[model samples]
Target: MSHDKKCVVIKIGSHHTIAGFNNTELPQCILPSSYIKKGNDYIFGTINMLEECIDKYENESQQTLEIFTTVDENGIPYNWTVIEQQLKYIYETELKCNSKDFPLIITVPHLKNELANKVVERYFNLAFNKLNVPVFQIVIEPLAIALAMGKTSALVIDLGSSGCNVTPIVDGTIVKTSVMRSRFSGDFLDYIISERLNDLLKSDTFQMTDTDGDIILSNNDSTTRSLQTKDSIDIWYESNTWIQDFKINMLQVSDKELPELERYYKEQAEIQIRQQEQLQQYSTNNTEAKLDAAAIASITNNNPLSQKKNFLFKGNKNSKQTVSLELRECYQLSESLFNPALISDKYTKEDGLGEIIGKAIKKAGASVSSVGTNTVGSLGASMTIQPATNQSKNNNPFGSSIGGNASNNSTGGLNGGINSLGSSTTTPEHIYSTLLTNIIVTGATSLINGMEQRIIKELSIRFPQYKITTFANQITMDRKIQGWTSSVSMCNLPSWELAKWYTKTDYEKESNKDETKEN
Candidate 1:
């Protein structure tokens, strides 16, 4: 990189954006990708600002702030203007750097080549024209992640807030044909939890409360759902937040273990109830019969099991309530991730997370197949082939051709492509064992205690012949710094300055040439 220009690397994702100067090993700023737009002003840089904006708007129902740069179902950014503003805020305000003095290296996810290309073009226009930045470089997110993990080839799985991105990288390049994505991610789990909680609140099993900590009854003598008030809405929001935290704290096990864990909690809840009743009876007998302090002291001071069994929620007005979450309910909540059909009204398991991973693995194998063993510069990847299912010619599940023209076939269906590679050496089994063996799982959702293990277990069962090694950095710093780390590493190389960064003058000249041609 040019010594004259300060350089920065940024990793932009649907949930958060990480940015910092190239000289630093760690990111200088990490901000949530959220903003509230007012008439002529925009508030961003922290979740607090968004919360403040929300509170302000809630108070004045007539003036609602517009949310921007929110992630869509496929983990892609929805707004360009907000994204630019976020970058501008980070560059000028957070980092205290002038755009003109620095070049930018950004990481982006490939939501298929065309959409990815458009997003890249949009960023280029924003950096070159709007921000007047001196230079810019784009790195695909999977490639950056792979490089950060110190692997030239691996399966990169990003379970972000909005969706899951399964990308296979070989020799530090994204295997575009093998990449797969789905909207089923952390947010879906949150949604299901909230939905289940709402149902629980409406049922006779739980009671609603008002601001003054008073019980609020359902309209038809507790037979109907309780009326939703501002306090209820506040409680629901806080409950969801708590549930999200709970998921990270708990919910780690194989699907079979979920039921057992639930039953354990239920038994603990019963034990707690029995303990409470016994304590009450002992207190009543001692007080009524005028027993001494020594008799009261004989009872234990603490019960850890009782504490663990308790579940509580509060209304916005500080009204408190408690109920033990049924073991079955807890099991069902986590189970929804592996089997979406459980929550879906139509009961379709076609889009489950495991299925998505299997399909992605298949695509990775196909990509390796395309670059045959005999080809020069090939990674010498191997696989164990299985027979493919018959499918319509138009709907090839594995987007890329297994043994045919790789360039033309790049997208595939979710279910049909898992076994399409015929008898190739680069089968799912081989790919999972060799080049793609180092599974690097990243993103906020991966913080859930057992998520990494769950993936390893599931994939291990799917491809028994392969060794399914997985790596997940639980630290937030490591998760967000992958793009920046890769960028810094690239900049340190002698050829990077000459090879990658595109300057403003070059961009303007190209734009002018295009305009002139159009005229």
Candidate 2:
């Protein structure tokens, strides 16, 4: 690999795509993996960008536009062309660079053998032929996570918008049979919040007097309006937009944290009420208020505990809408992740996220015991030159492929085989213990404020002995890039060239050999 040429890493998730040159701490382009084609003009990028474009076009009726996206319920790319376009947009438009100038390193999930093979084959063709690139490498998303966390092995729980993937990695390889998935994810939480917000809007407690409503509606600050809106309210077209914003800003706490914040709000409201009462007391004596009915009514109106609570929303038009939420209702929505019965009556014990984690861990432990520690993670092995198979069927360019035997490299990839230490381990119990100790939690779903803590608390009740590692701040909002960081770091190593694919000279030689064979 030449130092002069550009080296690029792309981390594509169900929600977003992150891309940048290697060695940078942060990615240059973080775009949503969504595209909408309206005639020849296409719309793609972050959700915010898409919203802006939608508003610009003012296309309230969405029936005419064709939407292209790769995300499925399980977070796998269903259409390779959509993914290819996303990458193409990043390379050609955002980065303003030719694909052939950069060696591409991309990430894929550990799933069905047939699916991964298809994805990899498409990538090779896209890079080598369409983009005219030099070399392409594929990294398993979970193994890249372990590398990013500076761990040889860990149980990675990726809670994404599409779904949750609980995978166990041992010495940098994913344990295929131990992997588990669930449909419940961040999108589910958003739906619950939206429902709860609508329910609150309809509650009698949310209504306010005309006078109180006037005071709240006149307030400039969103916080003051939120504090005062126990009165009247308005509903608008941006209900979903504001509900999402409120959840991101306010609903990041667990059930435990909610009570404390609620108490604080009550105390502050009481203090203000008491001050007003004191001012009124100075003006009139208690004995006089007994005879003066207006004074008595004023005192009755001063009770803070009975005051109206407010949730204020400002929409795209600067139009104001207000609703009130009971603190219990706010936190109860988040609990649906743990107790699916809260979301719907049909949910059983097996539907909970904790139950899914427990089952995945148990499966991983059993596989480790069965493999007997010597080859615990054979499925997640490092990249290697696979025996050249006939490419006419799939058009797979890299006879070299991933999911080979594990490599001993500390950084996790472009190595020979499973870690020598992993192969030499003697005790099955030790392997299980090691795998259970470091539970590396990553993905966009884990970004919710108290999400990591709640998962840890729930798992602790079930498995007290095993540790839970959330890698809290180690991952950014664009959690997919954590894996790209690891891959970038690993590829920068001097010895990475040992796993290099067909160089320009090598590609030429292979092309001639194939031509001769065809003749």
Q: Highest lDDT: give the candidate number.
A: 2
* Model 1 C-alpha lDDT per residue in residues 263-314, reported as the tens digit of each score: 6656765565556656766978653343245443333223222233235654
Q: Write the per-residue lDDT of candidate 2 for residues 300-396, one digit (tens) a residue.
A: 5554334444667553333456765544555666666666777788886487778888777777666655655554343334333123333343223
Candidate 1's TM-score: 0.71
TM-scores across all candidates? 0.71, 0.71
Model 2 deviation from native, Cα RMSD in Å? 9.8
What is the lDDT of every predicted structure here?
0.59, 0.60
lDDT of 2 at 56: 41
